[model samples]
Target: MSSTHHVTTESKPVRLLLIAVAAFILSLFLLLPLIAVFAEALRRGWELFLASLKEEEAWSAVKLTLMAAGLSVPLNTLFGLSAAWLVTKFRFRGRAFLLSLIDLPFAVSPVIAGMVWVLLFGAHGWFGPWLAEHDIRIIFALPGIVIATVFVTFPFVARELIPLMESQGADQEEAAVTLGAGGWRIFRSVTLPSIKWGLMYGVLLCNARAMGEFGAVSVVSGHIRGETNTLPLHIEVLYNEYQFSAAFACATILALLALVTLGIKSLVEHLSGHTSNSRH
Candidate 1:
């Protein structure tokens, strides 16, 4: 028994060391390009980098990107949470079909998704006449950008919440109901607390995607410089126009945003683990 225990402990360290090495190699491969971008940005010096931020077109792209991301993240969160709740908390026909549909964006190409939106809302398309009559333009506008983003990011929150909610079980909610707690009261006190971390995780992921989304948005936004153009689209525009420094600078900012978002997600996950343990 002593020899067996020794072998088991020894094997665990070997397994962990292998995993650590593999992860390190993968991370290095992933980070090389990002490091190259930062190196190039610095090569151009700090003054140029600072000036890139002050450029009028860059500023417009930043503002539009932030606005679209801000608007879309909350809306996606609401839709995600609602979908998660319905799918996880209830049983109904076509549940599997609904879940599959939620993930359709992941499988569909972004360009194709853009085309579908165009077909639905373009001037000669399905809702075009109605929208034109009301002067409510969608395609080639901010509304189109938002709609495209929402479509692509629809699954993030729901996917995050479903497993968390499922793991939490319904015991606490049942207890609240037994005590005559109302629906809102039970959800606020029990459900929300249980899933808040997961929800935030999803929101952060959605925000990142919304900020970086390009293809679908580009198709609908019409690439109007300083107007419908988002950050990613702006980068493409700059690259196309041979403004390499500005494009790289904008790309670097986006990379930084993604990194910050990832850091927050890691912190949230850490806190969530502590919260989960304390609840036990």
Candidate 2:
């Protein structure tokens, strides 16, 4: 029989002290704030909680958030898959440079990310007058919101899949080709299954960020309630107006979304671990 044991370098008392300190800090910052939101949200009673969510402004914010996530996630998914494939499967000039470019969005601040769109698409912007002449809108509109979201969340899926697909290698794809499989067939049967969990993990994170994005969307959104405002913006608007309860109430949705994303990610990690173990 063979067995493996994890030996700690630190003494037991020291390890326990470190763990206790870390847990206390985590609870103080993360758990406490989450608890407060729910507590404050319900402080006004259940009627107010339901009413806050049911309000037209809150409803509109929810709708816009959903619309943004629904539109951006799929487009990003496609981009991510294509980028991952191109970078990992083929050798080309500037391949390293291209891979580096995928993370540019992450390095840029979200506020600056939004401003770039404004500069290009705003009325006084480079193409602004041309778009105006054509009666087309990009900035301060739904299109702007979607575009900002796409820019901000662009790195998530591609970053997730690139490393995974790279480590996987092209052996399976080449083997499939040798057996007369087409590109689509090989991708669907071999590539897709191999990367499905990574893809899902990326999408979950993208969706959450897409829904929760504030700074980039804020600059371009114009804060037009019932038209362009998202849930995060709505919360800010309410908080600014001193509607603490309603703000917290709206925040509950975002908090719940975070919790859901965390749960799914944990589950995915668990399953992935199981899969790797099973394979080995």
Candidate 3:
């Protein structure tokens, strides 16, 4: 029995080593290109890199990207939370269909999603006549950019909250009701705390998507420099114009934003997990 146990224990280390090696190889495949971009940007010299920041068009792109993301992310978060609540907390006909539709953007190509929006809001499309009558343009404008982003990011919060809320169960709310707590009071006291971390995670994911969204935004934004162009579009414009260093500079900034958002999210999750364990 002792000899068999020793053999089993020794096999565990080899298995762990294999897993570690596989993970390292996968990480390298993902991280090497990002490392190359930063290296190239710095090689272009600090002066050229600083000049990229000073470029008026690059600044405009940054501003526009932030504006669109800011507008879209909050709106989507609210919508996602509401949709998640409705689908998970209530029993209704067609609920599954609604849930499935939330993930439609993931399946559809972003380019096709852009085309759908264009067809609906373009000069000769369904709502076009009414919008035209009111002289409201959506395509090739900021509104169109926000709309596309919202469509693509609609599922993030809902997806995050569903499993969390489901696992949390309704026992706490029932207990609150038994104690005569109002609906709002129970939710604020119980439900909100339980899901806050998951909600933050969703918000971070949504922000990442909104900030880095390229395909759908590109179709509707018209690539209007210093006006409607977003960061990703700006990077594409710079690359196409043979301004490689500047493109990398802009890309690096966006990448850093994503990394920061992810770090905050991970911290929130860790804290939430600790709190959950303590409560248990």
Identify the runs in model 1 with alpha carbons over 4 angstroms from their true place: 1-24
Could you give candidate 2's per-residue lDDT for residues 173-250 as a string of tens digits? 999999999999999999999999999999999998999999999999999988899999999999999888899999
In model 1, how many backbone clashes occur? 0
| Positional deviation of residue 244's Cα in model 1 after best superposition, in angstroms | 1.3
Candidate of highest lDDT: 2
By lDDT, rank the candidates, best first.
2, 1, 3
What would the per-residue lDDT of candidate 1 be over residues 1-280, giving only the tens digit for each residue? 6777666655778989989999898778887889877777666788887898789989999999999999899999999989988888778999999999999988999998889989999999999999999999899998899999999998999999988888777888889999999998988888997789989999999999999999899899998888999999998998898767778888998999999999999999999989889888
Model 3 spans > 4 angstroms off: 1-13
lDDT of each: 0.90, 0.95, 0.89
Question: Which candidate model has the greater lDDT, 2 or 3?
Answer: 2
Candidate that beats the other on TM-score, 1 or 2, i.e. the better one: 2
Candidate 2: C-alpha lDDT: 0.95
Q: Estimate each model's TM-score.
A: 0.91, 0.96, 0.93
Report the number of the highest-TM-score candidate. Answer: 2
Shift of residue 245 alpha carbon in model 2, Å: 0.1
